[model samples]
Target: MRLRHLLSASTVMLGVIVNTTAFAAAPDVVRIGVAQQGTGDPPVFGGSPAATAQLQHRVEDSLKTDGTKVEWIFFKGAGPAVNEALANKQIDFAYQGDLPSVLGRANGLKTHLLLASNVRAGVYLAVPPDSDIKGVKDLRGKRVGIFRGTNLQLVADNVLKEHGLSERDLRVINLDSAASQAALASKGVDAVFLDYNLFKLQRQGLAKIVYASRDGGLQFTRQAHLLVLEDFERAHPEIVQKVVTSVVQASQWSSDEANRDALFALWSKSGVPAQSWQAEYANQQLKDRSSPLIDPFLIARYQAVADDALRLNLIRQPVSVNGWFEPKYLDEALRTLKLQSYWPRFDASGKPIAC
Candidate 1:
């Protein structure tokens, strides 16, 4: 009887040990996908903490001691291709734009919005120098190139509607960023709706900037974010916390006014000239753009993106912003880092507010 009783206790101990081992198992690698690739051989990106984190190796540095490797996969196809990777479970996390992420959610991709990577990023409209087109309204009945399925498409639509025009009023061509630049330079397209890269073309006298979203105010700007797979988050909350914390640290550095020049220099690796970044960010505060908070303003912008996405038939169904954001990790990171008040909070109207 004594021997039998001892054997039973040992069996229970062995079961507990197996369960604990399974529970604590961590993946050997963490795969991160970036929607946009940079110009280098092993590309780098800019304009977000995810980019900063990658350039600085913050995330990898945090996990290196644990024997976990970080793999960053950049997509030349941008946000739409990132959605496909997410769908196939080929990536554990992604840095993507608002529209593509919403479309992914509507199509049943289970992920959590970690935090805003970049916000209030303006778009531009450029036409060939000496062209007859002078403004947004002039694009009516003219061939205009846009990178469809990107955050730019929705912003372009909104800007057109503001000018009493829609995409239907123009001959719209779906071109990627590089193709759009080439087409605009060759006058293959009458005008191109693009980002700061257009400034480079203007410098070369290849294109004329007719309109910029900065003049239209913050509502016309676009947003991007960092998101993690739902399954990955559930399985490794500790690793998720570390990743979020590391990104928050990078954000803190990127937001400082003292680091402005250094920040621009670091981001210029993406093939965009530093002067272009300086011009684009010229009246903007770094903290306002580089904020890692998932505040009310961020939520409102995403919800508006979802609404517009549906109204524009970009998505088959409505996507909910609620429960889509997982803020506890961000909250904990801010708290532990003693940076709860480091970044300013904004209201839904994009005005600064106390929280």
Candidate 2:
């Protein structure tokens, strides 16, 4: 069974591998960009476009003519690459991380935060297994690896702040995820801001997790959004609605308890290994984390993120967080699909806002 394939015990502890929308006169091909999906050779359960891609086919087939095509773009450069694509009006929808999407808006790429793809993603700090850095503060003056301009940077900075430290207090070395992992292996950096993949390094005894935001607070965790270009949305509301409908449908399937094993297996194609998903999702409810609702909680958090980014000089001009959301599409999708109560809504601090 596909579900059984996803839950194979040997796959659990091992290490491996590893949006948008809008409309014009319905372009010949609809380009969907996955900012964090670098080439997506090995599917990652975290935020892969696999589920949505399948859902997209159905939506497109029913909503458009046979000539219409769906084109997916995966960028290894992550958010920045997608941001560039969106800016050039090459991408209609973008499933992207919080920080880059925020910066994109601040830089004048018009997009509506349609539905949230994911929330409460964890950030990890990995240090050499033999290092004396017992906690965040211990590395104040030491070298720290951060993939600058990515959401991980903010998560890392926020974690540091929680420990009464700041990026200013440390020698911040900018490195991409792979390079940072390698740096940690070579002891090139005292610590590297990373994610669930930290487990692989731990298995290798190359690094150890010093801090993580896996506990109950949403603000402490990284967030991702599903966004659509404003121009496209303005041009074809019908297509945008269909896209939102499909996303909601996919979200519904994803939230179902019975599909857990199959869903994880689908994500295992990213070379992350099925077991890695099991470990990462241990004790966590899939629905609680993947709600597609564009609730106030995300809006408030983005406002706070924008405020902090302004203070931190991550963006030139202030990003209008409130304007980022155009919830009508999601609202309609939920209502039409009878899924209004399917996904719980939360406040910006991540508390369930009674539906």
Candidate 3:
């Protein structure tokens, strides 16, 4: 099938009309949902109340002109609960990992991508610090930790394939990030796929990366994005535009060094440790400013995800990139805010120019 047909259809032009109507009947309040990894820290990045406050502040500021009020609804549960809220239309929007986004879309949820956050280049295939394993090919016949149906798992598969190995060649163990990290530290698994933030573990000399995914173009390149239900978008188009605008503004603000203190402060108060907040904050900013601008390249990456998911039997049908994204609202928001100057310059053909 053609790529266009495989992805969601373009609804950019219709988005404006739908959004306008939604704004006209603006509800007294809008409820936004959030998801986060709950196992490790006090205030999770997107799930904790502290992160909620910061988001509320930003969204309120953006929607003030539209006479909209904001309320936050956080889900302490993991992936399944988040999906339930979205399916039930209990919330307006959500910020979640890439794999969940794909799963939600495949399940017929009306979700949209708002922005990318924290494109860490450090996801690795790690073994106990003392392990003799040296590369992806070394994992054959060994137990490997992975969270199935996730970006990490997909990347793990890609990396092994590149090394002439397959999942069938290893004993695959299913575990979440937190669990996988612990299993690696205890030497319970021969090798585990993990994010760079596990540097804390590496500092203790408990683990060492057998293969660095970033350098090999095999890293998950995970993106946390904001998504809203289709009915919500249809009901409150103007509000959705405001939400998108707020996200763009927040992303831009997050890129500034002076803003780092305030960002960390918010994160720290939300239950994240000061040190961890600092690390994640810096990583998110670096990604926001320097990562590949969202365009055809990203669309292709999403397609790759769809293809891989199908091969793994994770999802039943192929998904197209076009129908999944509606960039018109973003463009509209940028133009209305006259914040075009804040965005990187692109040619008439929509190619980004080097600064």
Candidate 4:
């Protein structure tokens, strides 16, 4: 479990037969899938300057001299759509949120958790101004907009349970984030569970904040993680290692205190307000949540997520969280970059566990 041990494993070494560093079986094109809303000018989600492009450049520089390229696959249906691509073997790597990632694995999609990009991201619950809805308790018997097949469905349901309510108690309407936001603003739905977009609408006096997981603590936050297809891992560990290194490097940069303002600005390029980003990350240290380390906290949290999915029938079977992680690449990357001690580590409760 130590960085030194993981990095020194023989499997972590680069493998290439010719002057060309391309794998004997490396695919001509590497496809990285984005499981978020879109990849437009101001994307809803993607790894543009984050890690995907950096991975492409690094691979071409050190391994693929024959113009091996990285292609990004964008999705509108979010995690469910990305799971389709992963199941069909159309993608080599993917970035996804909790529910679909775990469900895919439970249903036999072969992939490994590579890294965690962000955590403690609060889900926004917005009700129309002058509406009688006050909180989760008020959501019962009300029409609430939820994106069913995505993680939001389960996340919102869990939040409701925390208030002694359940999805069964409400009239749930399925809609994507964009449509959901519009519907809420138009009073088409009694309430909506979404992300920072809700807060932005709240600022405009179009919606009222009913409940925010921001006050619910780290255990309530939804997480996004990077994953690699298992077949690709067995065939091209070298490529996987390099790609993970790029993400680790990005995480390192994102966790620096000096980069806090710049990171928020870059994130705001996705069309979210700069002030919203500031509020969401308020009082949070950069490395506390952004650290790429696959620690005990992260592993245990994902385990509980899988368990919850089973209990709620979101997933048919249980997934083994521990075996699903391929941390050698991340460990190796940290050591080579001399960043083993650069980021803070925390336990399940978000308490500082290491540095």
Model 4 TM-score relative to the real fold: 0.87
Give all TM-scores, in the order shown: 0.95, 0.86, 0.76, 0.87
TM-score of model number 1: 0.95
Model 2 per-residue lDDT tens digits across residues 9-90:
5465343211132223566777778765542533333443234445335556645663567666777778898999999988
User: What root-mean-square deviation over C-alphas does model 1 reach?
Assistant: 1.8
Which runs of model 1 end up more than 4 angstroms from their true locations? 1-16
Ranked by lDDT, the better of candidates 2 and 3 is 2
Per-residue lDDT of candidate 3, residues 1-355 (tens digit): 5776545344655777787765678777787666645323332353222243344487888777767777666554545467888898787787665666777788888877754443333357889989999998889999999876555777788788889998999999987777888999999999898664455577778888667666674234554556677777876777887777777666666555676666656555554445655543443443333232355545555667777778877789877656777676777766776765564643423345666
In model 4, the runs with Cα more than 4 Å from the true position are: 1-25, 39-66
lDDT of 3: 0.65
> Relative to the unseen true structure, what is the Cα RMSD of model 2?
14.9
lDDT by residue for model 4 (1-355), tens: 6877876664455332342455455667877787766535434442223433333244445445544677767777889999999999989998877788988988899899988877656687889999998788888899999887676677787788898988889999988888998999999999999877776888899999878876876667777788999889887887788778877777777778897777767666566766777767778777766778887778877887888898898877777786898888988988999988887677877677854
CA lDDT, every model vs. true structure? 0.91, 0.76, 0.65, 0.76
Models, CA RMSD each: 1.8, 14.9, 9.7, 7.9
State which candidate, 2 or 3, has the greater TM-score. 2
